[model samples]
Target: MGPKIKQINRRLNELATEWNSFDLGPSRRETHSFVNSSDVIGRDKDKENIIDHLKEPSEDGNIPVIPIVGIGGLGKTTLVQLVYNDDRITELFPLKLWICVSEDFDLPRLLKLMILSVNKEENCDGLTVESLQTCLRSLLNDKKFLLVLDDVWNENRARWIELRDLLRSMDGLSQRRSL
Candidate 1:
């Protein structure tokens, strides 16, 4: 009975260690494709801007925050989507992460989404905002990540500040520049 209990404990430990290994999620090639953002119709300039920035991150390592700020229906999301799916840019950052921010930007939700975006198997159910932030800091502290905060409203300044603060906390994440 004692040996059986020890064997069970050893198996549990091995399973636990196995679970600790990172990333076990679904493939994203099935979704988040530029084809889904077909409504953007014509935004060649915007696509160019995104490409320019992405290119810098890939080739030159010097593209700024290239924000596509404008009123609604300007195809900001579509432009970014096109650039995101571009084959050239894909090879640049193999660690690509995409996050959606409509209006409300909750810290925990955003962090969990970011984690899941980067590491699909990341389980953030019991995690808090601080915990998630720490995880993001750990993941992005040394890595260069391109984040798209889509459809942000100009109304909520406080939430925006919080989100900005979290992003700013990242060391080498975003490089602010004009497009």
Candidate 2:
């Protein structure tokens, strides 16, 4: 009975931790790619490192995923903004798409956001996943592009793989980078 009680307590603690983590109260303000370079300070070295990585050729022929991870309020987004706005990045990838992915990782919603990033005027409200993929492929085909999926919080491996495979299906995305 004692061991069973301890096991139950352990399971309860795990459940509590999971619950607290998911009970995020307020919605975070969506982030954008634009930033005033003059206002940012002290992240030059980090920015340069990411830029160097981006400039390097992908040895594996896969779309390189560069994640800027840190605790909340630590300016991860700010550093990424600096990298995204850099002239070198712009020169390397002419077509840039920035999507603020907060919390939920719905595939159709993410697809719609990607489409909106490509063309803001696009009406993507009623489109299915197939349509969104087709449209995104049209915009990205044979073009050097950079996609920034910002503030991602999804932890599901299958969903991530689905998104990755979706990108992999595109023609010119083999050597592109996503941050």
Candidate 3:
């Protein structure tokens, strides 16, 4: 009986260690839009293609959604960074906003990030969706803006439709650029 109790205790300790190992702690890592163009290799053609598409006026007059799809660590973000930093992009779109969506697709949070990008001094805490929408609309009221939603993991179509509808509702958002 004593030997059996000791074995059980040993297994419990092992299980405890396994559980501890599984905890990865809080994620502090985040992606930003800054990139070193010289260090980037072999993505020039892809970048140029995206730029060309961006330069072309939308025939249907709707927001263009350009998706750079690839598995993790395949330089999708890097390629986007290159495009974002291009001089042509700056000339084409007067306003550019980069938001790292990263798994959580909370609409208000996204709005807050956009507001922050435009106006760094804004206090977006505790703002309602309507307020955020009004604020965003005011900022982008009559401007051609480029918004990049990077590292998005949300696949829920309904949420996307809601966001799309919100953007479409805004006047002059017709000339918006999104990715």
lDDT of each: 0.65, 0.88, 0.86
Which tens-of-lDDT digit does each residue in 1-179 have in candidate 1? Answer: 99999999999999888877755543222224355545556676767766765665423433345667787766566677787777766666556666666655566877888788777777889988888988878876766556765555546778767866777776764442222
Instruction: List TM-score per model, in order.
Output: 0.64, 0.83, 0.87
**Candidate 1: residue 47 lDDT (0-100):** 77
- Stretches of candidate 2 off by over 4 Å are 1-28
Worst 10 contiguous positions by lDDT, candidate 1: 25-34
Error of 1 at 111 (Å): 1.1
lDDT (tens digit, per residue) of candidate 3 on 101-144: 88788899889999999889888888899999888888778888
Q: In candidate 2, how many Å is residue 161 off?
A: 0.5
Structure candidate 1, residue pairs in collision: 65-177
Model 2 CA lDDT for position 105:
82
Query: Once superposed on the true structure, which residue ranges of model 3 sit more than 4 Å away at CA?
Result: 1-19, 25-29
TM-score of 3: 0.87
What TM-score, to 2 decimals, does candidate 2 have? 0.83
lDDT of 2 at 108: 95
- Candidate with top TM-score is 3
